[model samples]
Target: MRFKIGIIFIFLCQIAQAQQSEMTVNQNHYDSEFKANSELISEFENNGKSNAEFRLIAKSNDNGKISVYIQNNTSDTISLSHQDYSIYILQEAMNKNGLWKPIEYWESSDCGNSFGEIKIEPNEIIQTKSTKYSGNFKTKIRFKLSENNKVYYSNSIVGNINPNKLILPNDFSFTWPLAIMENIGKKTPLELQKKVVFLEPNGMEEFNEFFEKSMNKKN
Candidate 1:
């Protein structure tokens, strides 16, 4: 009896240790790498193309994982979490032959069965998982043709974010034999796959268009 009890205690200890190993990232993981070019900012305003402002809003602490958000200069309240923001991390190619890479995305993994929406007033911020983890931005670079048929890039690009998603449970594991097998290839609630886009002067329209399509599909 004594030996049997010792084996049981050791097995329980292993289970507890395994459960404690799951880790989330630090607050800094939610930072954005979306840097707007000063020249582009100036050129857009000079050309009378500036209509709105785009910025990131994030929150984190030792008690919780970081949450990321986007603030837009608009007039209506927006429901963002439902939209699942997609991010595009932009890479600069030296010879125009460099390939673009995917952005670093983040989002809430644990969601209760209850669902609620946060109302974002105009010019208010809405949340995104992509921003909460870590991010990379992709700008759609545009170049102008001169009269000499030469390509002169004002070195500016327009970028946009798009959304795709999956709905899953928050729990990462179910040690029960059947439970483990049942969840194979399933998505987790924390799995958010939305892209947060940075709009150049001309990207606003496309962003709105993408947003509208996302809503339609959700409905």
Candidate 2:
């Protein structure tokens, strides 16, 4: 009995060590990839102005991932935002104000300190990491990429908001910001929040109505 128990203990220890070794290998690979992608983004930031033939193509994969493919037509390498975080604006349809208002409140927590970017080699086409859309309205929505205060718009894609459908990791529920809550009918400025949250269509309407009613009573 003693010999059998000792063998079992040794086997368990070996299994634990094997799992730890695998985890270390995976972590190293992730760090390597992250460093590689960051370096590409830096190169573009430094020399992107000299290139003018770059193009941004938006694509939605079957996995509900929105990927922006950047085609570098210049002879030099260039970098651009990965479009995987809150780097792009979610614009609603053309309203009576003739302005495309940003209605997206989703922000990524995975990106810390700086948004992710990737370097595309000369004539190389690279796609960004997957990004999820959270707009609950059934309007024509588009992604807008801005650099140097100039906006670059993507092709419009329309879909209804599915609160049950989780398109992002670690999504939560939170109250709308005062900027959006106060300016219910008006166009709100493009402000990025810290965490991404999903709300049902009716939930948004109910909250907005409550906010408006409370404000009217105060007035």
Candidate 3:
């Protein structure tokens, strides 16, 4: 019995060692491929020693819409706040009245309040539907990351808010910044712009009625 147990332990050790060796080899290959990839337009490292890396790239599809892909480029796993992905109007992008507020948006899969861990192994990519803004709106994204029960923030991206083309076959209803949309309609200042959140048509009627009434009271 002792001999059999010893043999089993040795076999388990061999399997673990093989896995670690394979992971090391794959990591080296990923580093090389990442350096050679030309599609990567920009990259960002975590402000601190946190081993999280981010990459941004854009591509045009057959439908004539541009798809902006955000990539994770580190060996360590990252936990992201899935719900607080907002389209923040940069300080330079704010106007005199401060009409633009950070528009809160959520994906269908990310609608619930949950802490999701993003484990994009080296050389892997993840995709999500970005906020569809209109006009010349410059913007950035703000969210939270978790490490050892402590939360850290990614830096505010400084760049143009690429207009993601969202087309509807019918008259889609949307609610933008009330101070901006109710007052200025679509005429924004030359510098500052608006981000509209297109509500799904399923509960459009009820939501619009309730939301408009609530805003009227607040105003």
Query: Residues 172-201, candidate 3, lDDT per residue (tens digit)?
Result: 122233443554434432122221222222
Sort the candidates on TM-score, descending order: 2, 3, 1
What residue runs in model 1 are displaced by over 4 Å at the alpha carbon? 1-69, 82-97, 103-110, 113-116, 125-181, 184-219
C-alpha local distance difference test of each model: 0.32, 0.44, 0.35
Q: Which model scores highest in TM-score?
A: 2
| lDDT string, candidate 2, 35-141, tens digits | 22555455445444533456554555587666554456688876655333334333334333545544443332333454576566786655554344433445454
* Error of model 2, residue 129, in angstroms: 4.6
Misplaced by over 4 Å in model 2 are 1-53, 81-99, 105-117, 129-137, 162-219
lDDT score of model 3? 0.35
| Best of the candidates, lDDT | 2
TM-score of candidate 1 versus the correct structure, residues matched by position: 0.27
Instruction: Write down the lDDT that model 2 would get.
Output: 0.44
